[model samples]
Target: MRAAGRAAPTSDPAADASDLRVIGRVAPHLWPPGDREARARVVAALAFLLLAKFATVATPVAFKYAVDGLNDAAADPRAVLLSLPVWLVLAYGAARLASVGFNQLRDAVFARVGQRALRSLALSTFRHVHALSLRYHLGRKTGGLSRIIERGVKGVDFLLRFLLFSIGPLALELAMVAVIFLVVFDLRYFAVIVLTIGLYVWFTFKVTEWRVKIREKMNAEDTDANQKAVDSLLNFETVKYFGAERREADRYDRAMAGYEAAAVRTATSLAGLNAGQALIITAGLVAVMAMAAQGVLQGRLTVGDFVMVNAYMIQITLPLNFLGTVYREIRQALVDMRAMFGLLDQPPEVRDAPGAAPLRVGAGAVRFEHVDFGYDADR
Candidate 1:
């Protein structure tokens, strides 16, 4: 499940999280793993995000002039037409450049981050698996733990990508919408848009929280059912000896039925989440469009200004939706992190004294003074 590597043994998850280790916890260890050149590449990529966002918002402004100039042919037909092509070309070129830059950065960041994460997880799991007492592995399912590490590392990658690139632009665009309104339209209109967005986000979180809990429960149950089936398969000889094929099938069917039921519930919750997001976005767009129209009629907002508002509205919604997705992923990543921390918390069975003298070379002698041993059935 994991590639070759060397990492310190895993600690108990709780202990890892709680330990006063000033270094490890403070640094999430998920940053891009490239050296100096890689760091430069990541910085360049971030610059691209800013450029992309600016280019994106700037396009509508260019169109506004194109529209106004085309409308005013009597003012100077040739001049207007000449400027139109230039503006269109610049806008298109800026957008295309931004697209190329953003993609390159995204791939570079994900690749670096993913490689580091997988390498770390592989080494950590390998070392930790050895550090743990034989009892721990005997009781735990190796396959399940392997899968968890694989998934947890991917989750961390997702978090880093979304947090680094998507989040900043999302916040900036929302602020831009408010700023544009305050500059060109009424404060009241900006307030309305801001308030609506806040409420929508609040509602989305509450609904998503409930759905996540339900999904987690469903996942746990599904895992249990899967484990049972795996056990049966591994013990096929015993099952055949008992002539319990039909019985095993029945049990498998029951597990599958429960899994399907949980899956349906999860699907339903996801559908509701999408619907809620759509409604919230539509309502916010309508409010902004209405305000823009009012501003235009009152002669406070120009046609270009209206176009800017529409662009801002789109910018706001796209990121808000993305923010919701990011938030959910972050929450999942945190949960995975907490589990990892919990694993790190498990104390080692053997530890050195706080301060001890170095051993001197001498003839070996075996000694077992008052040996004691016990085993817990539950454990």
Candidate 2:
């Protein structure tokens, strides 16, 4: 159920408020829910998530064991150089498969949780819009209003999946890896992993922050271009009578030119961000590998342990490569969803009294006093 004293959500996406505020506004509809089944599904989803993390963390270790067994076989004169340990190989494959299986199970379980939340929000928004005063409907564009709600609806699903699956699971896996290193290996190895991760994350945040502005520019220009084209085409007869087709085309081209420039910049900035993040991971891998090599040469670690280090780093770095992009999109999702969420902050133009009654066919005339709803007045 909703927390106490929160503003009621409206259908207007332009309602301005913080993400937490917006989420709180919709919280009642999604959680501490009246439906017991939904809560169960949420619990099941969390359980699956934990299972997935366990499997993911174990996968690298399994592969390491397989590699070590093969290394031993190679050194034995009685054995073939490429002879494989059947059980180790099977365990490694199982680890990989189990991780994927658990991940998919989590998604399947959580799908209902997300869908229910979206449905509730969408229905609430619909009812709120219908309850609004006629002036509110007259003042808003149907296309813009629809797009805002659509984005907001889809945004909830995206937010849930990204935060729960991508960010949460990856973090848990990282922690598990850190623990494994501390318990079974060296502190220096853990430090290398941690340092590389810290640098990679720092670099990603800095670059992604820069990209956020570029995205804003691109979105603004793209909207302007689309709006200009729509307005011009919709008023084609007026433009014909005024002999302004060429003028319309020029304005449209100018808007598109701005959009084109912004789009190009976005592509270029994304490439740079990817390259910088890759470099951070590469350096981290080299440092971790060096430590592993030193340990192996000193007989402090087995050949298998060295291979495990590489496997774990490779696995960790693979997901991290997309972390920046995922984070950026998550931020954008909040922004897109904010408009609808912000509606909660808007006070309605009309509301019934405590003892209000539904209007009847012969209801008395409506009356108002001391109201200043000028066309230009901010709502």
Candidate 3:
């Protein structure tokens, strides 16, 4: 029998696959073959995504024009109040609203697609678990199995939403911002933005990889604690008869203690990651703003140009700030999914011969001929 507070073993090969491979396994469910309606929703959602990103990028430009218009009409207070600045301000507001509106529309359209994928994978996993042999079921902890499936389903939903919406949109916005910097500003500004982004991404991935190991330990302890609690509760009559309540509680507490330590380590590492990311982003912001200030003083750029540059920097870095969190979660999600998929990879221990005919009896007496059956053949 498997010991309490220990995770069941899974297929190493399945668990060892890359995150992209895991994602590929999920892609068919998200965009199923020959499903016209689902495909249409996905297309519509992507269109809305593009629209939202376009509006998001345009918002700062409108604000820049409004600022410049106000500066030009500074001598005429009435013109400042009731001229081109007013329209540009209105356009800015509209662009902001459009960005938000399109994002919501995208979510609304894509909700069904994500839900369908979640439901499909969940049902498949459920069926697979049921199909496994009794020996496999007896060897595994029920609570840990459920936890794996639960986490895997949640990971699928999160991956579907973020991979399509957050990561792709962030890349598109960065490319647009890069072009703006090069065309409107100078190569120096472009270089700073690129270098900062590169470093931030590199640092986040490296740190998050370290954190993934800690998170895995935490997850293992979580599973162990859950398994013990469940096993104790399910066999409460046995515990009562044996008077082992204290023993069960001690086992649970030990598992929880491990989980607590792992959790603390995870949080501590996260703090370091956040601090490092903030430092890099702050340095980049300072460098860009300093250059913009120099440009303004030298008459090469305007107050509006400075404001626009600041807006673009904020726009790019804001998502980047969350990039670390998103990437970490994605990695963790892949791990959870790998465990669940490993369950599906397990082959059934008993199977009929290929093309075996179904048994048919008219008047039959069951007979055992040369029987050779043992639960453990070595025994």
Question: Number of clashes in every candidate structure?
Answer: 15, 6, 0
lDDT of 1 at 257: 83
- The true-versus-predicted C-alpha distance at residue 275 of model 1, in Å, is 3.6
lDDT tens per residue, model 2, 1-379:
0001112122234533465665565556556557888888888889988987888888888888887787777667566434566577888889889888988988898787788788888887777877777787777655556666777788777778887689888888888888898888878878888898898877776676666666767666666676677767778799999999899999989988887887788777767777777788889899889888999999999888988888889888888877876777666667767787665445678988989888667757868989776674565
lDDT of 3 at 204: 73
**Over 4 Å off in model 3, which ranges?**
1-17, 350-373, 377-379
Tell me the deviation in Å of residue 129 in model 3: 1.0
Q: Where does model 1 exceed 4 Å of error? A: 1-28, 31-38, 74-78, 350-379
For residue 35, what is the lDDT in candidate 1?
A: 62
238, model 3: CA deviation in Å? 0.8
User: In model 3, how large is the Cα lDDT of residue 282?
Assistant: 94
In model 2, pairs of residues that clash are 2-28, 9-344, 10-343, 13-339, 13-340, 15-342
